[model samples]
Target chain A: MLNPPEHQVAGHDARLGGLGPLADGSGRFFKPLQSCSRGDNELSFYTSFSSDPRVPPSVRRRFFPSFHGTQLLPASDSSGPKPHLVLQDLTSQFTRPSIIDFKIGSRTWPPSSPSDYIDKCFKKDRETTSLTLGFRVSGLQIHESGDAYYKPSRDEIRSYGHDDVRRIVRRFVSDSGLASAVYGGSDGILAQLLELKSWFEDQTIYHFYSASVMVMYDKEGVENGRSGPAVKLVDFAHVVEGDGVIDHNFLGGLCSLIKFVSEVLTDPDGEGEGRRMKAKKGGTENGK
Target chain B: MLNPPEHQVAGHDARLGGLGPLADGSGRFFKPLQSCSRGDNELSFYTSFSSDPRVPPSVRRRFFPSFHGTQLLPASDSSGPKPHLVLQDLTSQFTRPSIIDFKIGSRTWPPSSPSDYIDKCFKKDRETTSLTLGFRVSGLQIHESGDAYYKPSRDEIRSYGHDDVRRIVRRFVSDSGLASAVYGGSDGILAQLLELKSWFEDQTIYHFYSASVMVMYDKEGVENGRSGPAVKLVDFAHVVEGDGVIDHNFLGGLCSLIKFVSEVLTDPDGEGEGRRMKAKKGGTENGK
Candidate 1:
């Protein structure tokens, strides 16, 4: 966003047109910035992704949304000085697209389905027949308010809840050749995501003071097999960096959130974070 | 140091004469390498300070100690391997200068002296007469063992203690003109320190683990009052950069430690921390 000239117009998804008013077809998702975060880390997230040089171009566009810049809507009360931030609308605003505004600070479970897509993707044996891409969607909406950390509270999870959500959103392609041509391996994607995370850490040097993760993915495109969904961080603010290098409280909230995301992405099953980390033994993500 | 050529010899203290066996008359300090850190950061700190174009020469030499370079020593048992990092020993090693090792990870109180120096230096009022220099010495020493944190124990503090520690170790000169000439204002010193901290954070982008601060000064030399004691961050190891990005555990230990140090230094007299932070009316230590 800072280097190259801005794209004159946001890439629009014309396919979504006529589907509904919400489908006025902007480049994929249109998340409400206010609803995107827990009020913290919103501005910094946009500013960092929008400006920090360390964040490479590919990660900026592919892994994260192309920040279409920000806008300020008039305040409702008109007394306070904040209209807050109105980011490029990546929400299913005009049309309800089977969305789930998750209860703030909770991890939604993986989709379990009897559909052939899940069968092809979740096969324990690595049969390279499908060569599928599972863009697992999850994020840390948790905020560090006193002792309220980012974690499921007393809720035991189960893997047996059968659902057809796979058919609803995830895209499954049988042609391995075509899939390979269009999308990179999970290893590459994971590396990019991690690089983005590391970039975030470096910004903490001047002390970006907000702690919440905003991972968003466009289910509309992914469902139709047009593109592989991405996990992009959104909505960050309350950053007083450069001179006042202080995080009102403990700053480990960002570290904990990102680490959990890595764990979740690498090991979606019960608990294989250790094994999954070990599997990437060849410095698999280095050259990329 | 990584980029620039190593200094052939550590900057020496001419003041520490033939002070016997213990007084090796080395640069200033001789830290046990194993106890120093994991060894990765030690080199970078020196290399970065030694070479990075952004780091001013004064900061390179005065604020940070000169890197004498690394040495591989023979292990005592003669079986295991050991590489000793030969830092320019900056401790009051040769001259029994009154020093505080600060029990690795605890925040020790300031040396509340009843001496005339303390009275002059610690005067609460804005004594326009003495624009004194106070080299803040504080840092973190928590090893990445599980998720253990950095904080002091429940031991109560005291102001009075007696030992044969040389009184000449510390020099609290009240001359406003001399302090400004030798050392820039306190604001300048802080900006340099924060800049140094920022450099450390950038290196962490490649995952340099084990974060801490090590500040050292000269005892025999400061007694003569030739120069204000310089603050140097030392003894950090376990750093493997470039793509090996993984926080062994929580990573806020550094931020917490540094932030606390800034707090302690700014508010030396117990609970005035809140008030002191607000008193920086001007952008005194910024813009650099």
Candidate 2:
């Protein structure tokens, strides 16, 4: 049976409407195919990337969800049965997963996008910390070692400032007064992200606009030092071809994220005065 | 000013409705962005292929229309302005252009497509010459020297059998009393299709489902021998990733088409009885 994803921290929710992702118990996540261009773009991205030789196998296995083609299922809204892109559920193996979705890139919209879409993205980017910080913590749920769970509301997440974001990042890594093994060591989120960054540094194949970097870790498994962490790239509805040009916008945003995560590791407390990222105006073109 | 394309022999027309392609006076074809997946798929194909190094430069340049990004244009149906993918007009330079759009592949629908879509494509393929000949002339326009023109209607085109399609193909290449210089030379339609065949023989990049191979030549230009024939692959809305596998369905259909065209080159008249291609049953899988 299909059910609302228990661990989805960001994006649309099917419990609220018919247009969100559904989780099947059999380690599968079924994302409802949008009736618009967004759905087409996302599907196309997955299809092309699945077999692309330029993307290393290690990167493909570690940083991307396994695509299992598409299927038609009954709609949650009772509108009609629609197609869904079947993907591997990221949190399927976790008993208690602590997940955070970070919407990467300083600008979400491409230059070729329609004026109205550009305006919509521009307004949202300025309203959030995205325009300033290069990346924004869209949503997060920190599961403590105990039964305690900290899931921030949408408004609260949207209202986060640079300092607030820093505090949250520190909190996410901290469990029972000690740092979790999810963000540190040789094979952790930081290392995985750096690997992705390395790929992005030279990849001139695609410009991933409005894409997200999702980081998740099983708190219980982390306590046992078993599963560690998983960092995967998600969302490609607004992705565009790079056309033999490096995506500096995404690279810059990724670097900013790395800096923040690195700071959390080095300086857990807010004692040291870290350099603040300047709040830039306009779109990604100007940010670059 | 945006105008209806004068030389567009097939596909949707903006003059009929709001949801079709428009021709800019300045050597550009503006295909209106469909609000659905088809538009997105087509856009993604063009974007990826524009820079894909796997596709040889010669193949890219000669067999595909040049892409110039997209633009927002006022809708002909007065539904307000919307985005349109801008592409190089294939017949921009021709004074009296003769064109034929051949919907290639024995099975137009992919196996992964929805049941309804498969049924629709199946019915059409059976009704036309596609199921038997591996290709169907979707539409065509023959331009004779002076002011004579022969444009087949949609119904007439649809009703064409194997023999009728052969006659039309011969008629397209024949101008006045002599055979036109558009289908026999090294730089002709046959040679270009052969080049595409060589690429498809080993290419595992994409499976072009429901794609069309368009053949066009200028009647006046043929008379002067200044410009030769142009063979380009068009319509990529249903294109899917090949996943490191050869698209045998498309390759088989292409080979069948090569046989038909080759037969025409060797025996222009219907007197020399040609081998009839067996009409295959079922989808592309069965066709393969």
Candidate 3:
């Protein structure tokens, strides 16, 4: 039987009364297939991506969730059965997962998309921090310590400007006000993001639009030194073939996100004047 | 376009005038789906095995090929389109791969099978080394250090007795008259088989009958120290749920196979008198 994923911090949530991804208690995540075109596009991306020899094994293993085919399961909305993509549940190994989902790239819609869809995406991108910050926090759940947890609402996440996003990142790494154990070491989140950045810098395989980078770590596992952090690329419904051209838009946005993470690691406490000025300009545009 | 795999050493070969498996030139092996019941059974095994929390990650990653879902492609027999189970091509990384396929277990047919099917399987099992050694070499291709290769015919392989099987194994590890570089190290084939032995020793989730274990290595890669050996469990059409009981049939067969390989590693030159006696007894049964 499938149940709403407890560790899912972003995207559509069935717990809030909608069709969304479900988790089969045993390490499998089932995402309900969207509309025909979008679903086929995403399925095609995963199918071809798995067999693409151009993709390095390390990059594929560390950055993407393993695909396990698709299944027709009863819909969460009781609207008959629906085809769902089966994937490895990233948070299955964690006991108390702290997860953050970042919607990658400044633009969410492609040129080929319908004008109405483009307009809808453009409006959302402008209103959120996506236009000014290059990427925005879609949602996050910070497990500080013990039973205490912090999960910001959808509205709060959507309203986050450059400064708010930075603060949220800092809060995610606080870990009960101690040195965060998930972002500093040689194999930490920063290192992983850098590795992914390196791949994006060279790869010209596919252009991802409205994709997400999900960073997750278990607070208990980190505190106990049992496990480390993981980063995965998700939500590939808008992915398209790059046609032998560099994905400059994705690479640029990835660099921007990497910069934010690097700064958080390097200067955990210092709030520089330069950052404040940039945040102010971004905030002004967001306010407009 | 899918073409016949150049490195395939066993099973039904389309290149040899049969509807068998195809390789995508990249890294995918597409096996044509069989009869509905058998195909569904195999598919079900892979689907559940992938997500079964009971199976350790190490076992899943090392012993089984990563499944990339299934696709409907043109049949090699020109029998219209058919669904194919897509999987990681184990020999994709090798420049000159040497592969061996071993059909595991003594009893190939289940008790629930029809009388004619049982009789056929029982006759074959008794004819081959499966009844004696608990496993039989279904096929093999040994690349002996250069452009030279050794591939025994089906009739020759079927006629192999206990001593012949041992001789064949020794030839595979000879590597053009030198100590084989693919089977002795800490991470080599021996160690990998031992690791799989440990898992089968304890696992009780499923019973695999008539399954095969494929061992492959690139002779050139091993000579250059570029790549090592890989062992993957394949062909799950006859697998059945364990229902909380240990799979004694598979476990026993695995242990027997392990013993044979272990002896080859330890006494590479010494043919013990005890082994001669056992071979004589097994050969007597085969003659009967």
Candidate 4:
């Protein structure tokens, strides 16, 4: 049988206690995005990359300055009622799903009793703003086994493929301007805070983990070196911690850091424009 | 944005894995019919309840004699060139998909090396089987998430639920009976001896794990409880040794066990017949 596997990737990395519920610690805390396994933590923070290949060197470099080693101060001067509402807007950009969980510090290992375990769990939860999130996302491109699983009979004209799905999602993101909106818009506040913490906590981690199940035919012509496309999801769960949990002062500061990072990542136009101009100048200079 | 999940459950576990090439190994391997947790590995086994409620007592007592640690030897005692085969026929008796794995020891944590990890994983897989086989099967229900992962979308409606899919497959198997005929109507046979040994030695340790996402809905007559008429597979993945290698012997043995288990699980007339009869009599006498 030419059954191929589909790929799927799912997990959530949320900030603990950061987005407390309006009433009773029940507010939804995280949003989720697709992921895969290509790094240390199976999830990664952005350094930089060029989406378009036509950008010129010097101009691109200026527009896309490296923030690889940059770190943001946890506490900020921005605070109070008039505190930057920009933080709220930026949170929406950090749209991966969030979960409420406690981190186990080394000191709490091997709790003395059940009550101790609960106490440890609760205390750790209170002191930790960075939470370990669990969310699963999987992708399947085809039904391969003949013995019977999810495969529709010959009558069902299913034509699912990973590339097709990716194209469709990406196309939708590009066409609807969601990426830009998320990058440039001021409504993703909750998301921004979570994203900021995730990146800050996992400075050394890169790449993401994902699984896919695809029929052989669906993967045709794609440069995927993998033999078959079978859908599967790899879950990435992690503990994220900040400089402090009780300090509300640093919230705005984290938001600002995220904004700076976001600008560099999403300013496709700025760097893209610079590169085009530089290429034109270079070409003319060479011609002379 | 009501992008209802891409898949839904089809109520019947055994009914899934019917997508053939489309349903191939992705969803099938990921579902461990016994439990839903990814961390806990459970064997793939099926359960069938009697239509007559009166027979509960007898059915409970002996319907599953195997539950009392019945040792299921290789299909036959023959020592000739014939290899053992466990063939199971698809039927309407089961509502869930079952697993067939192997175990040789207790679960050890934090495997020290690559080989240790593989050995532990294999033993855990086998242990699950041993436990399931020895205990009276409880919490035996179909997995709805298995159906959802495999369900077809409106844009791809040719996809049907697990029940409908199984019906088609059973019909196909009934009509063809080719695999059975090849073994002279015996349960699955060792297709080849060489393949079996190589299968065993060639086996790679895979940290196999699976979980199903169920869409639960309330049953019409049942209060407080829910009934899932549909199921779709949600997530599945594995970690194995040898880069991409697998032990052919273990796999072959597993396949045989699955086929055999399916046959016995579905066959009410098999060893479970006497117990079922007694249960019916007891229930009728007691007006239960």
Candidate 5:
């Protein structure tokens, strides 16, 4: 049975209310809903594919719908502020070093299925595939009490497929690759890589603070259940502005910053420092 | 004794005119003197110890001296534009990767020597110490006509010192020790340790930059040197800046960027984005 009282899981499925009063085929809805989170509480937003017979298979949250709500921690608790996210990449042997968290304005979505696109693209077994893209937008909002707020909690992640996103990721990876080469086959290379990784991860998360959709890797579990390496693509998108395109106000330099960062990160050998670097053995290249 | 005029070794030095005026404690003289070089048509900026007697060096020129001239590159040669400086870390095995070259603005102390304090503090081994932080700073001239003009090649190199140079190096190493402790020692600790090393190297380089001192290290020879690792510090505090503190402007941000970059390049598992990441030997620390 599905979870009851949909509101309880609002953090998981945001579209629980479904399409409200569609005006016509033009894709405009007559009834609009608005929700706000408060400073005193933590907010979580989530969505899961539903199996309701009335909904179509192509849509995520078909039966259950997405949810959003604020979480109240015990007032007596001390530890300062609670970290927003805790993502554990099952493949990594090292422990989760820190929480992956960020604040956002508001969230909008399309909620469509895209097969195992994410896993296929980043496949490690030397599989060649076309690059796929995806995106999410979360809106920024001002609370009734005059506080500024961003949507979508830190834990929930969204991916984008736009050429911009692809270009950005590609550049980042390339820069990182050059950096790796410069470090050569030394232990120092590893340290450099770690700091870079932290920077990239942190920067990516920071973009989410505005209205940027994050990059996500599907956790390995389903196919064999026993768990191996394969990751599936999760269906989700975030909207910061009215449409999928982020307004300059919310995500002004985020895309460009992401691009610059990726370019810097991918070139490991210091090749991008106005020069091209040669690749090392076993350094595989993906993406056309 | 110091390789008089006509008998200079081929790769040792050269003399160029139009270096403007030379200033000393006594007075200013406008004379063209012969200079030395390790390579043909190469210029350098370096530091030296003023007090030491065996190499009891006299100030070659003032610290961070300025040269007022223009350099002309063929623009046809594929090597890109030649930098006003061709710096290297004589103490270390590898040359600095990022700073291949740079430009010297007007109002420079034409033929001042690099600071001697830098060399005294940076000891390579117990017995054989580097006399001066040797390097070349070529490509000198005065701009004439429009954007393009004939500039007399006035190339000179000198050395000077600062009391705080050694203290800065020690402080950097100390800070690195603290930073490494924060992230070292765990299952993949070896790998992590390597990462921290890169971070430290970058941080060290960055600190030097902020001090307005251009320090370079042999990337390839750090570990193989006579000391724990091979690195060199060159004092350019005397180089005259037309508008502001040129050394700090070039060194500060660069050092930070280099450190940040070096750390990223050394990442072992590529920032934990793949399937076999779980096979990383150590179990994941989910709670943290």
Candidate 6:
């Protein structure tokens, strides 16, 4: 069963004051836009990017949600103000009300050298492959677990092969219940996944952080000849305005996440499924 | 020198994900109104208080700010919306923009039980007592020294003697350079202080937290004969609804602060000058 964490189970940073007031357990998916971890005010950056005139219409069209207006909100414990950006909520558009929050480039996932994985992903899933990959929210461990914490596992990063990628997509789809036919078979799914990854990669180049890559589909019993689900990026509090052509950190982190899932999905003797079950078994054995 | 810490110093409670974006270092004084620490959403409570029709117009006129309007702001970390109430910014009204942030009941000063001191302050300042108390940006310590934190001496929390109250006012006034005549004399300052204390006491009884009592006066060099400077309550993020009864915790805190300042100001040696010199001297020595 997809777990519904108590809505109040939100995360907070102690460097700031207690955020007890910010998280009221009401299942209202209102994510606040914060300054980037690097200390840039993301409201200004995200709002500008989402609606900035200088950005090409084509680039804007492929990604970026429709920009909602901005408003100043009271801080939790600070004597200052912050601004929040509104985007169209995906749940409102989906036929099935089920939603999951899959963070891109997050420390919660195994960390890897960022770009190596992205390049590998690009080679396999380019425009022709169109694969749709959905992530299991249950596997994304965001909470601090022991001393290891939820940060990216930077040291053990590696690129995954096609068999690996396919295996991972298989698990994600099982949870999603979306048929391979809906994805236009294997080739179509790869192409879609590649496109989704490319869009995400572009976001990284622009410096989006702690972003959520959401897959919103028709949850109805019959999607009736629909053209697959839609994936979009949201929660842009950590996005930065960059001067360099590429954000290597974003590339490396995104690559690491994509690569890890790919690894989790592969195994020739069906050992991939065995390994997946083992990991879950181990997690539960430790009383997690 | 007033030290400005990094504006990016954000508050966090991990029991809540990364508050990385919450603390941006803009010098804007925007404190968020939370559900009162008691669980009442203060934005609703304060705006309601500032605009409640049940309140007598006369009392409301004397107490609340002119109501502006309210708007829903994006939550920085959550998926739901929070409302922000806009009120007049006082800085716009003053010709010279020097402001101070004094917490109502604080740890920096000695602790006193709340009501006793409020009663003492009032009996003293009916008129002729003009005081201007701007809280120290830190605690009432008003000293820049070593890193010793402030806490009230709980055992000595009783109301101060009249001489003690007189003493504290003396030190505060000397800093202001106001004439004895302006205060209506030495006795006048104490009465005014008590009056000031009383006003703040009223605020706490009303269930305000993080409230500041500001003394606004004509900053111009000369006064053509104004009665006294004005002191109003600001910062209502923690304000709560009350049944017209005094909140003892708030009273105890406010009283303690007033009592401690009184103690800091005391000296029978007619060396009120020496007493003043001694307190400043003592503050520096303790490396406060």
Q: Which candidate leads in DockQ?
A: 1
CA lDDT, every prediction? 0.31, 0.76, 0.76, 0.24, 0.24, 0.38
Per-residue accuracy of model 3 over A35-128 as CA lDDT, tens digit each? 8588998988999999999999999999999999899988777777999999999999998888899998656776457879977996797788
What is the DockQ score, from 0 to 1, of model 3?
0.01
DockQ of 5: 0.01
Candidate 2: residue B81 lDDT (0-100): 87
lDDT of 3 at A126: 72
Per-residue lDDT for A35 in model 1? 28
- Native-to-model Cα distance after best TM-score fit, residue A17 in candidate 5, in Å: 8.7
All candidates' TM-scores? 0.34, 0.48, 0.48, 0.18, 0.21, 0.31
Model 1 / residue B285 / CA error / Å: 31
Error of 3 at A202 (Å): 1.1
Per candidate, native contacts kept equal: 0.11, 0.00, 0.00, 0.00, 0.00, 0.00
**What is candidate 2's lDDT per residue for B1-288, written digit by digit as tens?**
888888888888777874688887679999887767988999999999999999999999998989998898887677888888899988887888888899886568765678798779967977887655557889888886576679879998999875677677767776533342567768777788888877875576788888998888886676787777899999989998854334545654565566556656777663443322222222222111
- Candidate 1, what DockQ? 0.07
| Clashing residue pairs in candidate 3 (N, C-alpha, C atoms within 3 angstroms) | none
Better of 1 and 4 by lDDT: 1
- For model 2, the superposed segments whose C-alpha errors exceed 4 Å read A176-180, A273-288, B1-288
- lDDT per residue for candidate 4 within B1-288, as digits (tens), equals 111111223222323332111112222122212223311222112122123242244323321111111122221112212211111111112333221112211121212236665566535433342211111111112223443212233222222221222232232223223223221122222222122322333222232222221212122211222321211112222212221122221222233223333443254233343354345465332111
User: Model 6 lDDT vs. the true structure?
Assistant: 0.38
The lDDT of model 3 is 0.76
Runs off by more than 4 Å, candidate 1: A1-211, A215-288, B1-23, B26-28, B32-65, B69-84, B91-189, B205-211, B216-229, B237-254, B257-288
Model 1, A66-112: lDDT tens digits are: 55544433223233233243344443221212121111111111122
TM-score of chain B of 2: 0.91
Candidate 2 chain A lDDT trough over 10 residues, lowest sum: A279-288
Q: Report the lDDT of model 5 for residue B166.
A: 19
Per-candidate DockQ vs. reference: 0.07, 0.01, 0.01, 0.01, 0.01, 0.01
Give a tens-digit lDDT track for model 4, residues A204-229: 11211111111111222121322211
